[model samples]
Target: MNNNVYDCAIIGGGVGGLTLAIQLAGAGRTVILFEKEQYPFHKVCGEYVSMESYDFLERVGMPLSAMDIPIINEVKISSVNGNSFTRKLDLGGFGISRYTLDSTLADIAKNKGVTLLQETKVTGILFEKNLFLISAAQDIYQAKIAIGAYGKRSVVDKIINQRRVKHVSSEKNYVAIKYHVKVELPPNRIELHNFDNGYCGISKVDGGNYCLCYLTKSKNLRDNNNDIKKMEQNVLMKNPFLKKYFTEAVFLYEQPLTISQITFNKRSAVEDHILMLGDSAGSIVPLCGNGMSMAMHASLKAFQLIEQYLDENISRQNLEVLYHNKWNSLFSKRIKTNEYIQYLFGRKLLTNTVIAILKRVPFVTDILINNTHGSKF
Candidate 1:
């Protein structure tokens, strides 16, 4: 509210930003958080979190066990030709909607004394003279440090002059679609069904509903004349598993949530004296279905680094270098490997062959899936 300089200022109220805010506030630090949207809203996401983050979320004040949501431990995957395989997940996961999760975290932070600014967007962040000058709706505030947790894309990236991820002419962009439905899928299983140029994942979230989300190249929609239903029939229904759900499921939303230009390119951990967290830093290809856990994990690392920075225990350069190194150590190889995996899925011959191989040697499939996910944190 006032122009008093804060110890830390966070942009975006997603999991990463909210986790950092909760940690800082709980530590008795003066923190201010800015969010462009109100709580209890939906976003285009897979809506499943890896088991790695289950304990940490409980520590952050979410009553996961008490929520009585789905605990998913089995995986079922199908290829475009309808060939499918099922396996037991190495580490199980749970599902919850962002609408409920984000709002709950916001409440926890507010109770912890975090100065949360709702429906307020951070327009630009400028670092000058060892301080961050933040601009939001004609108001400029100051903070010792700024965290960029803004999801997927934001004008703040351009203001910081960060390089955009380069996509080739043929495969330059992708689109994501999400919807909650009343499907007859099992509560303990997560499914990934492949179709032409895309894949769909289904899992149960709270309220006894299922999250049916998919990612596909932009060209698929364009080829279908920008009609989602047409694209589904022509491209996705090729997989019998997906066809069944699309036709038989009870759609809960009038219109599906969609986001375009989703890119999984390399980005810096720290930029312009600001630490980038979550999707703002780098995104894991969604086919693996663990992006939520990665974002929450990165937030924990960011909070630790910020504490060292504010306490003067580490030099500014050291803080930047440590966070950068830590991020790469934990996620660099995983992102690169998933990028290749995404490319592999886009090819028909390769995907079918891979599925055949996975069916023959089920242990190999477990190894591949484990590579994309992290251990319990």
Candidate 2:
């Protein structure tokens, strides 16, 4: 944070970036975390976190259990016509808003000596002489290591050649929307309802509120004249379940949180001389219901490897190679498998048939769920 070069310069302050910062700082290493937005903000996230990261988070300093968050053990999914089924989650998850989660991590990161730079937008990053020159609006700073935890999309993707690897043509057409509302959904369950071209997830977070988030093709909104409400009423409401909540839930915000050009395509874990973290590395489809945990899980991986590199336990070359392979082994298959699974979820008839088949044989559902989730870290 001072004029001196840092041990680690982290770009983006979402779940992955913040968690990495906390660990690095707590390890007695100098860290600086850059976030475009201030703390305690809302993000377009499902808010449901798989229990896999529960111990890791508490180990890093988040008193998550004492926070009194919902322990969601059941997953309820429905089809367009309202045909639905419930399955017990194998490694069930919990729910907490990004507003509470990220900000809380920011606080811990600061207390542990991380230079928490809120509202600081990083413009570019350059690697030279085994050091990183981070270009922010304020000024260029130097670091021995740099990481990108920026979510979904960023200009830095192009800056680091992350755009060269094409997985889904271009990533400029996907859109996602989210909101918090007071709904009468069961606190111990998370519901995902499917319709043509998209799906919506509902689950309880802290403060007796529910997180209502969904992802849809951008064309769905385009066809409805770019009106979110109209698109919801016409497409999402066709699910029946979405319609019921939309018509009756007490919306908590004056407006919904929306993001555009969301790309779920696979990305490289290591680019140039920078290590990618969270959504930066690879953003899995939100339908997996574990992006938050994956992002945090990634932090655990990056922090350990980077620390070994800093402690002279390994060479930089070995550090980068290990991070790449470890990240892929842990998350690559899940994201790739979900890409195909997501295609099935987008079509109404395919979703209905798939759900109906899996309903009779519930263990298949567990296999799919387990495929997407991971064991406790």
Candidate 3:
């Protein structure tokens, strides 16, 4: 037995990775977390968290309720042609930036005694003789279990599971852009404005700023000579609502943050014998507005299974199988449903028609929207 081996090693420092680290360390387990970037960094995220995770976060040392966060209870969605309608959200969410949330979670995890390694990019992982070796930068760490909490895309995906990392140009990839700005939007409302082959979500986060983020097909950027400003001016601004917001809002950044080569393809729950969490396990469409909550919920599930495995109540194989089954049962259906919805709204005509139908049958809005979210976990 290696004297320096940790009970668990986590890659990436996003919601799932951080929360899982906090839980594991809080339970008196030796845990090590690797983060490629430093804390308080911006990410290309929608920045809206569903209410399902509010209590769970408060339970895990995040004082979200005490913070003056924006409570979003209403939603406004507009079509490509700017035809729109507002509806009440049955299980509404709140808004907070990844910059704030991740950093806060990191602080909590540290206070709970988790060894967090920042600015350390993991190079590889190898499972040998039931022990895992994690190679990050120039250091190698040993652990009984490893977790892939890295989000969206990573080279580790290829290093550990070559089959899962497909060429970006070969797949139906998407690009997401995010910015924080001063905008005059209702504090209790979130808006989804649609354009050709894409949608943008805007909501007020803490610190008196709004998170303006959008996702679109990769081809949209290529078609515009790979210029984000050109794509925004020609394609996104075509929507009257988008145009008004773009023109009226005070842009806070010289350049927006971006992430590319994003795919919603089904990812395995356990990759190369390491538990996968958050977007690393599976990704839902951004328009669903539940990815943040889902990631946090997954950490809760992973923590439970990992605890049993560490306590020797469950064998490693059984632990893997149970986590896989639980992950599928909790999120597979919702991911597929959101995929279908994304496909329908990706087209201009269908998006307009769907908005019209929802307006006419306003009651169905609650059902359809609520289907994308799960109850309090």
Candidate with the greatest lDDT versus the true structure: 3
**lDDT score of model 3?**
0.91
For each candidate in turn, the TM-score is 0.97, 0.96, 0.98
Identify the runs in model 1 with alpha carbons over 4 angstroms from their true place: 164-170
Per-residue lDDT over 70-144 for candidate 3, one digit per residue giving the tens place of the 0 to 100 score: 999999999999899999998899999988999999999999999999999998899999999998877789999
lDDT of 1 by residue, 1-377 (tens): 25799999999999999999999999889999999998879999888888999999999999999997899999998888988899999897899998999999999999999999998988878888898999997798899989999987887887886554455464848889999999999899999988878899999999999999999999999999999999999999988999899999999999999998877767888888788899888988888877788888989998898898889999888988999899889998889778878887855677788888899999988878888999877
Minimal lDDT window, size 10, model 2? 164-173
Better of 1 and 3 by lDDT: 3
Error of 1 at 27 (Å): 0.4
**lDDT scores for all predictions?**
0.89, 0.89, 0.91
Stretches of candidate 3 above 4 Å error? Answer: 1-3, 168-171
Lowest lDDT block of 10, candidate 3: 162-171
In candidate 2, how many Å is residue 109 off? 0.4
Give the per-residue lDDT of model 2 (tens digit) for 38-120. Answer: 99888889999999999999999999878989999999999877889999887899999999999999999999999988888
